[model samples]
Target chain A: MTDATDFAGSSREKWTGFSANQYFICLKGILVREWLRYLSQKERFVSSLVRPLLWLFIFAAGFRQVLGVSIIPPYETYVLYEVYITPGLCGMILLFSGMQSSLSMVYDREMGNMRILLVSPFPRWYLLVSKLLAGVGVSLLQVYAFLAIAWFWDVRAPVAGYFLILPALFFAGLMLGALGMLLSSLVKQLENFAGIMNFVIFPMYFASSALYPLWRVQESSPLLYKICLLNPFTYAVELIRFAFYARIEWTSLVVVLAVTLALLGAAILAYNPARGLTVRKQDMGGSQ
Target chain B: MKLQSRSPETPRTDERAAVAALELASISYNYGQRKALDDVSFSIEPARFTVLLGLNGAGKTTLFSLVSHLFSPRTGRIRVFGQDIDRNSGQALRRLGIVFQARTLDLDLTVRQNLLYHAALHGIGTRVARQRIDELLHAIDLTDRIEEKVRGLSGGQVRRVEIIRALLHRPSLLLLDEATVGLDIKSRATILKDIRALVERDGISVLWATHLIDEVGQADQVLVLDKGKLVADGPVATILSSTGTETINQAFSKLTGITDMNVRGGRP
Candidate 1:
């Protein structure tokens, strides 16, 4: 209710203040809010690292005697199956973590909070992409933790392999992240999502090079080798496999990029408000 | 329908039509062949509080669903501020906010976190959104309970949270679908007062969808949907006069032809 002069100088000051304040807020949003969510979920952090450690410990011990990993291009000397599968195992960790985060979407929807999210004014794509990015960030942390464990086990990659893995991990994470979004939007109920783990994930993982190389699988059965090569999970494991050896595999990169794009497209189609799975009734209020 | 033009000097050109913030024309929806909203047509005028009254099986929720774009009608179109909703859903929806009959909130997060998540999704910047969150907490009387998880909130408090959440975007058109289902009179009055204040102070258009006759009055406009059709539309007193009834309770029964509607019994 003050006069004209009081408003004039304040309006000038407010304009510059808004511009400065907005950039600072956006920075805080991505780093503090998104990154801090992972730090808060202490159990998720622990479990992501634990599942891979179990595989490296007991499963690798049992399989090391039976499985004979022949000469791989990256390995000059004959390495044990234990050393051969570490990269694939790391990829398995990222793959499972991505799908695990995606599977949680149905639970969030059933609990009713997803509705509050969709109704917001932001373009729906940004909201989802940011959430996916946060999931990727979590996957990256778990991947590093797994690598640290491998180093402790006396099975180590080259010093430069870690730097090379950054981009490889990024592509693999995007591909898996996209798959998670696709599964989340398609699955209606939280209970129904168990199929994603058992049907979608396990087959994709087993069919890939995570356990054995494509050449070894081909030696056993050409049909199994073909199945493994066709799997998006194969590219995920192969990409990580090559990355661990500090080598580049162009074919794996192409396959991972293409699958990532395709999955993201499918997820967006399934989530589009018009006829997508999101239109279904979301049961949100309390039972009481 | 009366249109209110804004002053020439202001850049806000879209502020037109004080009489009906949202208008629907011959809108119809179906589940394959079975009609959900049967050739329904209605207009919700601006500033005047309106209540959509109906029975349980009537198309009250269906009508609200179509209006809110949860499910669009297969036939006809919906308009908000003279612009067709489908053609400009982003702009139209950005200008409108809704709270469903069922509460839609994240139970895992704290009330403050939940609101902040919504603000980020709504594209509200961090600083302004933070300030808005504080203001909304004060307005909804949840300032003290901001840090508490939503899983622990009382039913009435949860309901209040949902209402305030809907109003976060400062929508020109606010849709409340069965907002006061099981609340006591005190909670109900607070929500009603908040909505009333929105209309008086912010010029926000509200469509209060409820089956209860006590919620709507003689002065307010009322639309009765019986069996997926727009049964009657006008001021409560005017519409009631056609049935030769004084109170909305008697008028609702007379107009919709419900003779055996007992207070405690199930809806037929």
Candidate 2:
């Protein structure tokens, strides 16, 4: 009706000033969409669990006889290889899920939905943070789902550790998600993400202490041991591993927190409108 | 509709009284070494339907991007309601609504969901957002289809939904870039008429960018862009008379130096 336009115009004056409510609404919208997407694609839930499950079941099962565990701090006695690698596998889920979120960012940009997001009235940093938070939320769900499946596979943490792991997993998920956001900002096209998976994800996954203990890697080579110590993923795995035993690794917690803040800062800078990868290409016609 | 004739160089008193809904001064953009938009300047008055006419690669979309703040201009300044986009982009953007040339709807989301999400982005409350969505869907005659996924809608229906999304925040200025590019003739007419009615009734300023000559009506202001340069800007009648052509189509061809009619088949 013609009167509808008048109603909109009159109502516009009432809502002129900015409010914190707007930020929450925007965040809620983003999170709900992501949740809906996750729900709709049932295969993503299965596949996210599958990668970690394979490592916990088949890979760890093969390495069980080859590798012998020592009395790690959280464990009172020597544990099986599968148990030793559970936290790392959880880190794996978060890592892959983070990259998957970035992949969707690329896809959204290509599909023009990113434009809608960028044009929103909210500050760019708030938008990016909201997106990162949403990614963490989704990845956390996947981590829990994987953990549940691992329980069924006869790999269990202390009952209290399950609760403790929530915060630890949240931190790790945020850090990984932030890293993924940074990678997405640098990547110019969707096709280039495959290169990132090999160059960034795999390297970050393997070179870290995710698959093997740092002490073991040190026994093989001291230089790699140092690298593993420095890898943020190493701290993430350590944080989760300690939490799984109902203990706190202050060192890992500090490292994971510091790395998350740093990566998030970098991600925000990379997504800045004037200097961002996407905006640059949009201005310069994809030559970059 | 009575068409007011005015010279491009003169700004009427009434026009000067109201702040421009959208303004770009000496805006230029470079894509590598190639200039996508040369030093261009124009301003649209509040509540007027202004047509930005350009052929393919004539810098229409580039200008739209600049106005929308998707790409900051290398050389010039853009303002919405007199707010400089570079200095106060958030405020300027708040007063602006944009419908891009590309399809931006999330196909998996239902029509209501898409609209609600957009409303949330603008900070509208859930109750107000739902009411507005219902009103908009009713206005577009797509009320029954609100529950359907966007992918299930016809191309024209999707475009209508996009228009509603842009209008949800009740922005003072609306910019549509090639909004009717792929629509059938009937759909195009409906969309064009609807936007025109918005201008007439709601007093919402519009910058409708397209390369189609037929879309330009007599009363509308026309800005002709040629090879990244603004070759003409005035009312449709003024543009026609200035180019010494009887029709806007011939005027466009004469100004742009394109003689092939098939090449001008409502594209670009």
* CA RMSD of each candidate after superposition: 5.9, 5.1
- CA lDDT, candidate 2, residue A97: 94
In terms of docking quality, model 2 is acceptable
All candidates: TM-score = 0.86, 0.92
* Sliding window of 10 residues with minimal summed lDDT for model 2 chain B: B1-10
Give a tens-digit lDDT track for model 2, residues A170-271: 999999999999988888788899998899889889988778877789999999888888889999999999998888999999999999999999988887
Best by DockQ: 2
Per-residue lDDT over B139-253 for candidate 1, one digit per residue giving the tens place of the 0 to 100 score = 6678899999888998889887777667654566778887888888988877787777666655567898877777786236889887778888998778868878887778877
- Model 2, B73-156: lDDT tens digits are 889889887878877777777668889888888888899988888877767767878987887888888999999989899999
Query: What are the per-candidate TM-scores when only chain A is compared?
Result: 0.85, 0.91
Instruction: Rate residue B98 of model 2 by lDDT.
Output: 86
Candidate 1, A1-288: lDDT as tens digits: 012111111111221212333333323343344454566578888888888888888788799999887787677778877778887777887888788778766766776556555554344565566667677887888999888987899877787888788888988998898899888888878888878888888888889888888888898899999999789888877787788678888899999999988998787767665653565533423210
Which pairs, if any, clash in model 2? none
